[model samples]
Target: MVFSTEAVMRGRGDILHGRPALVIGFGKLGSSIARLLQAKGVQVTVFDIDPVRRTQALSPGLHRRPRPRDRPDRRQPGALRDRRDSLRGEDFSHLRNGAYVATVTSSEDELDLAELPDVYTRTIVGDHVTRYRTTGHCFYLANDGNAVNFIHGASAGPFIFLIQAEILAAIRMLTREDLAPGIHEVPAPDREAIAATWLSYFNR
Candidate 1:
């Protein structure tokens, strides 16, 4: 969330302060991004296919909106338009100029590029970059519709050590003879032990 938002706001020259943004998912990562944007004073509108997730977003001060309508009411002025206009039935023609669209969904279908009108321009930001442009709106595909934090050639910083420790713990659990074949939780003791080991190493 931080990296991509920085890329768009700082690198791409899209000032997020006081601008409107549409976040298409409200899961853990989505909610985090929405909160971050809101903290920056961006008016955020969120949409999720799941009603429960939509309700969750509302608690964080995000405006909840239903799925984009198939056709936007064309009577509104261009500057007054909202995400519903740009995302109207998956075509981004009506999105407000200067607004941002960030899709943090696991499924690419959440913001299908093929559904976009053919007149827009696309610039390659990276090998797997999924950003697109129509007029003044900037659309960022959070990790190109994949997990944003798991992009290739990018480091997870110090958090990588913790993730490694958790994976090791999970492996140890799998090796245990008493463990069942189905999904199982990694014991808290194992996680604590692994975390302690990392902390001790880093303290040296």
Candidate 2:
């Protein structure tokens, strides 16, 4: 959210307002980004390989939407997934290839640079960037196609502590309580309480 809006689009209200954005995927992360972009007045059109997910996107936009049986939308930034054809060959000059979207997609096909048409020139730019001049446009590719979100180092700021605390709580529960031998998601009340406590303490 911060990277795209702040680093690329320059923020939600100013340049992005009323503009149309094509979101490439419709998973958990993608849905959230699409919602945020919509909230900021950007018209969002989602492209997902799954027909179920596509149906879900047709729902009235809400924070808590239903699952595949009823679940709502998702979004990934521009990604070149040949198998799904979500963002096939769509070259982006504005945003570098942040492969966070690649991690989200299940396609095992590797990105073949040879397939990128008419790339007459390639130049090493930054530690994580390579400049490629195509037939008529120049685009940048992030090295290893790794997510740029970690550029700030391993620390994901104070919000990560909230996740850690939940993990700790889960471990404690596992040790102290008898949970049924199956996958159990953390209950909503527990999550709400933890978030409330974190906000009260940290917002100080």
Candidate 3:
């Protein structure tokens, strides 16, 4: 999701400086994205229902903690990274004009166009982007509100799949055979093994 956020920012020319960016869901993915945007000088706002979990992973900075109902305040977000996939068509009123909205977690229609308010214009803006103009506002939706990471969500890059599979296999292998361990971590060898697998695959 961090890489996804970076891709979105870079794709949009990194013009997010001093602009508000919304990150829905303050979990691992959303929090990481919020921090990255903040580091890049974009003012980030995170929305999460769980007060405890939301408050836990946030970085030491002035983070806005707005309740669900109070979201989409006066200042519209210039960019929106939705990890929670909770956006609706009615939510468009609070977004900045021409903001690129992408979902990081689910490859589902986070912002269903059918739910969009009666609009005068909807243009298919190239691959993976659709522009909709309602009244005087405009915004872009990536992959038809599907996840930006994998719009074809059924598949994943073989390299990433390899790493995740290897990690899971390693943990399974280690946990089943160890009895003298309680909370054993994947040591250097396991990490090196994973890296070696990647190196070999890349070389191949």
Best model per lDDT? 3
lDDT of each residue in 27-122, candidate 3, tens digit only: 656676777777878777767777775676364473655664635544655445554446666777667777777776453535545667886377
lDDT per residue as tens, model 2, 86-184: 332333333233312222223224244444555437776555455666554454444334433344352447888888888977886787566878877
Total clashing residue pairs per candidate? 1, 8, 0
Give the poorly placed runs of model 2, Cα more than 4 Å off. Answer: 1-28, 38-56, 60-77, 80-128, 131-140, 150-155
All candidates' lDDT scores? 0.57, 0.50, 0.64
Best TM-score goes to which candidate?
3
Q: How should the candidates be ordered by TM-score, best one leading? A: 3, 1, 2
Question: RMSD to native for every prediction?
Answer: 7.1, 8.3, 6.3
TM-score of each model, in listed order: 0.56, 0.48, 0.63
lDDT of 1 by residue, 45-119 (tens): 776667898799888778876545433222211111112222433545555543334443333444445667766
**Which pairs clash inside model 3?**
none
Q: Kindly state the number of residue pairs that clash in model 2.
A: 8
Error of 2 at 199 (Å): 1.7
Superior by lDDT: candidate 2 or candidate 3:
3
Sorted on lDDT, best first, the list reads: 3, 1, 2
